[model samples]
Target: MNKSIVFLMVILWLAQGLYAQTYRKDLPDIAISKDVSLHFISPEPIQYVDISTHAIAGDLPLKNVLRLKIVPDSVTHFALTGSVAGIVTVVGESFIAQYNLRYTEGQAFTVPSQVNILPEHTRPLDVPGIALTSKEMQDFAMRILQQPAESTLRKAKAFGIQAKLNHVYTAGDHIFLDITYYNKSNLSYQIDEQRFKIEDKKITKATNVQSVEITPVWQLYPNTAFKKQYRNIYVLKKATFPGNKVLNIELTEKQISGRVLTLKLKYDDLLKADAF
Candidate 1:
């Protein structure tokens, strides 16, 4: 099947929260400089945006494919890389468009007041943080769903942790808990600085659980549907579930006052690994 056809099917699945996007096929093709510094400006606020060029045929250099960065300098103007180039398409929750451009060694280019965030019935929500948008989120969510469901250790939703748990395992005396934190409400939390803690609900200053460590499995930003759910793996030390089958976990936002999430985990809901 044609790549465009395949992408269209995926696009349809995402049309619900996305705007109809198209490229300015008629726009004059731009030639990029050797340094690959391309720039453009958007008139309206881009709630989320991503830009990429499709390979026409054979393999392209890894740098060309990976160096493409859409860095928003401010609310409207942003920078693009010209070092590697091809036909670039820009898409967002409320906007969709493309720019036909070529990256030629030693040639630099700047967009001349081009590109528009085509009007849409549903306006994009101006959420704080990265402008990666929802397209990337949907792409990631699909990837997560493609994983084997049996690999999921425990799935639960509460305290800003959305939908499902990613994975869980135990090695020696430590317990590893894979979790994804998401923001579905108008309220937003700084994911990068988020923290976690595990304690016994029944006992005050209990000595049962030793230590808990958190490792970010993925970097999270705002606006993208799946991106909102930042993935993390908690390395718990000497953690043991009591006979009563209850676990208490807390999520905290240092910047916000009274912004803490308490998760009540039941033993029966937890899928134990073979080691346990």
Candidate 2:
């Protein structure tokens, strides 16, 4: 081949190879990306407790409505959304709903990138189909029941992030936290006891407990559900004091920050008989 012709042919071949490369999509590649993520995470480790005391209300779904109830211990769905829509969303099915009691098969997968995702329980965890934490949902249920926002003291009807205290609230003092919920129901639920655990990093003896009442409030959207039940295992530090001399409520920085940690032991009882 002529030297100039051969050089031209080489250039053409290189151009073809470049064009054949896989891009974000088919058209002219505006920005190319090799940024993919892989998630190697344990199924969000939940401290699952069986319902001990069922807080049922008229708004709770009829027991007959549950096709499946056991939440599978699987890594819930996750995704990474980008801006400037040339869109192709890459996400998986909701692990909680997908791996229900009905589906006896396991369908968990790892992402391509080695990223560790810790699924923290917030009022809103991005797991599709799963709303607020079970407790928050129960708070919603309680609101539907028309429970007073304040059971004498503390705010229950307002909204705040769920956090725990760093120290075990000594048996004789007030432990405080801030919180609220949405239109939801927590069937067969229980928050039997609330105390600051020994390992929490938030609450301590030095913390303050503000004496503000948090009444459980509900902003229910029309046409949804039948009944709901929710109550924190720990609300008032001195829910039932040894003596009725004078109950004083105090607020700590931790409580004010809404990061007060409390150990809540929960239990569940299967209520498939009388639908509440």
Candidate 3:
């Protein structure tokens, strides 16, 4: 056999092998109207999920009536509810699946069906979904700032980030971290980005930290302070805080240049969860 022909055959074989190893698949479609619920199982831990909707048979716009209630039963399984009367496409880190929501006139919809997706050779990608809007963040901050300071769990000042952990509570499987940020600096400072991470000293290796949903005020005037909150949910794997683990929250300033404020959280700090 010719050398070029042999090389060409080897390349073709590799291409076929690569194509055979797939990760994403489509979920079975269903007809739905009013309120409905569905369950889907993922072969691997879903790190990220993207939800989009479309109407197939109904005259009503799905976006106007659509609301999602996604509850994770486990790392790979979840239940969805709400105004799901149309098609929903769920693209996660390791799988791409679709659910068809058919409008069945005025019939009350319940649990439709369960979908199970098998993982393939495709690798998961790092993608972030939408965060809270500016107005929403500002309003939430205002509400927190209005509360009296004496209600806070722990108040401390450090590294230009004078703040207090107002409240910490767990709703269902999600954890909420409510905090207030005070500007102790002489000049005005604006928040560039907020970083939340779980720092584990036990393991020297890097941890697969989960994403945080936060609401922060963009700017803080001199001597003025704002409050922000974060929700840590939908984490595929959660870290245990018993082994000297601490939650680090960093607020960076773009106006004041490289200045940053760090707030370190211990396990004890999260223990005091009370109404404020």
Candidate 4:
């Protein structure tokens, strides 16, 4: 063989070997079957999952665990035809994982423990710190509920119903708003809707007022009716608005007695939020 040709062949072989090594470092293949479930356990709660094909079904039985199984119909087809391969992606709070899926005939496989899958990239830290899981945030909110009221000046009343913003707490990347409702009337208060929004501090007939709605990450109370008094905690992502904007917590009542109450908070109120 010519010297130049021999050198070219040697270079090609080396390149192929390097490619194989890189592929070997990829995530382990997950074996799935129709009769058994394959579980992927992570350190953090899984936020999202993507399956390449419909032949595989996936679910989160727990916040940090993902279960995957091959569809029964697909299993029969695979048995008659051949094995099918696809990709599975799992996204967590701090990391992203990708796995090669292999469909086979026997029992499915489960991870013995939490597996440290390679992350595609590191996620940047949010303002204060990493956000807590839903359960953790709920537990913290319950503790806040037990604390004494911190503010009495932020209040609104109408039709013998009073709405007050009692306390504001901050933890991790979230803000907790403690509020209470007092019904002084003999009749019960049936809540029709509760809205949180940021709107212009002042509005005029000629000016176009713009309002932005804010959704709570979680709430401690789900009840809508109260005879005497009720206290609730709402969790929201930590955010800041311009000084000209105000945060409005509005509550409306159902039919017949259509009463409404709103508690407004200025930017300073959010600045006063105590650390949890």
Candidate 5:
């Protein structure tokens, strides 16, 4: 009954508030340098692209896959910027999906971290569940279908923010990124293991990249028994000077390893007209 009240309040809060989101980049609790430092923020995984791996992924370097290779048409940051579900109008430590409206830069650009709040505007009470991992999908689905009076709720540990830059690069371009996160451990949390294309920075583009699925990594099958269950949000970050002529590019998660993955530009370059 207590849980129902809390969940109900959350539902009413979201359903009643209908404020439109503003454009901005989401930064971390601490400040960072944009040049050589990459902060691994915890961003909600795009579940539609979630993949799973069969066999255990052996020792692999994360840098090989998470590097940025192309410039994006729009840079968005999913972070904390809204109101607490059951709290007052003032948004102090609320989570938000920050979409930064920008294009690629010939030179590196730095976005400052500011604790900006979305102005208190009339918001619909029916916003979707806060972005989370696939396993958390059940909760999201529940929030959408079940009424607050009947909802079963599980609280989350912390909210996270991540930046996605859409870009296309050409051949012969090189990238080097140095990424940093809250703490190496806090930032390494990941899910969906099929997206990693493991290799060195020296090799620019290779078509034959191995991929996997989400079911295998989560071990969600009823037949299989497991001791621990994990819920993670991985932040795939690009340091400085990603690779060349890369297009239609985005970060993905591998099935078995829970690492960040990216597609190479050897095959195609995304034009401004074709970008999402």
Candidate 6:
């Protein structure tokens, strides 16, 4: 035997072994039935789901937030004959999962009542984005809370309630605003609406005022009622506006009392935000 031929054969054998290990045939099977449905729960929100065959169907009942529901397709005539198997792939925000789906006549004791996607069975997804997750945002907010309030922006007081902007911080592509509300009176403040908008600083009677609403991407410490004082951190995407416009933070109380507190943040105030 030639030395080169032996070396070539050894390389081919190693390559084949590596390929076999990568695509193992011993995937765990999930039993599916027309009458019985299978539910899968993921650690994070699901991004995509792919069913390899027409014998089974899958859908995100909660709009792909976290749960995936699977059922056997009745219209697939081939499923009625005998056993039908397919592959199911579920992609989540941080992980990917694959499973072998098998159609069965009826639900059996071996059938899993619910499938919880385990971290060990999933591979990490390399999603490209600078956006922070909710948990990360919340953790950042906690760090901001530890800093002393240094902002002296506009404040509002109404119906024995005082609201003010405490601090502003900038990081990457997002801005964090720390706000505090104090109830001077003993009555509890029940917040009905919390809104942010950019509007003209000065409005004339003859001129129609234009306002654009800004929605916060994340909020820390979400609560509706507070007695003495309430503090929260709101996260918003970084944006730019003209000097003539001001960011308005409005908090309206629930019905009956219907009191409103409004705070204004000028464009200059946003520019003064300290980097975290």
Best-fitting candidate, measured by TM-score? 6
Residue 128's C-alpha lDDT in candidate 4?
A: 33
Residue-by-residue lDDT tens digits, candidate 3, 100-212: 44334344435453445434423334444323322333454455456654555656665555767665643323344556666655655556766666666355446664434
Give the TM-score of each candidate. Answer: 0.32, 0.18, 0.37, 0.60, 0.17, 0.67
Candidate 4 regions off by >4 Å?
Answer: 1-45, 52-54, 59-69, 77-89, 95-136, 150-153, 200-210, 221-223, 237-245
lDDT of each: 0.43, 0.26, 0.45, 0.76, 0.26, 0.75
lDDT (Cα, tens digit) per residue for candidate 1, span 1-276: 999999987866564223222335564465544344354343333333344432222221221121233222211111233223445544333454455555443423453223333343123444444333334434444444455544544455554545345655444444445566666656655433444434444654545754343443222233122336556444444344554545555556545443555555555534454332
Model 3: residues with Cα > 4 Å off, grouped in runs: 1-147, 201-239, 274-276
lDDT of 3 at 135: 32
- Which candidate order results from sorting by lDDT in descending order? 4, 6, 3, 1, 2, 5
- Writing each residue's lDDT as its tens digit, candidate 6 over 46-92 gives 77887665445666876333332343344344333344455678887
**Using alpha carbons, what is the TM-score of model 3?**
0.37
lDDT (C-alpha) at residue 197 in model 5: 33
Q: How big is the positional error of residue 132 in model 4, measured in Å on the Cα after superposition?
A: 5.3
lDDT of 5: 0.26
Evaluation by lDDT, superior candidate among 3 and 4: 4
Q: What is the descending TM-score order?
A: 6, 4, 3, 1, 2, 5
Q: Which stretches of candidate 5 lie over 4 Å from their true place?
A: 1-34, 47-96, 99-217, 220-276
Q: Which ten residues in a row have the lowest lDDT in candidate 6?
A: 15-24
What are the per-residue Cα lDDT tens digits for candidate 2 across 1-276? 799999987876664443232224322212211232212232332322221111101111221121112122211110111211121111222222111011112223321223222233122236543333343433534443453434222222212323222111211132222222221323321233222221222345886533323232212222122224222323332233222122221111223234222223211111111121
lDDT of 4 by residue, 1-276 (tens): 999999988876664443221122366665566677677876667878997767778899987888877776665444433444467788776567777666666633442323445444234333233467656777888898788876674898988999888888888778888999999999999999899999999988998989999998788888589999989999888778999999999998898898898889998998888897
Please tell me which model should have the higher TM-score, number 1 or number 5: 1
Candidate 1 residue spans exceeding 4 A from truth? 1-163, 191-227, 267-271, 274-276
Worst 10 residues of 2 by lDDT: 51-60
Candidate 5 lDDT tens digits, 167-266: 2211112121111111123344343422323233343356543332212222122221112332122222212223432222223333454344343332
Return the lDDT, model 2, position 154: 23
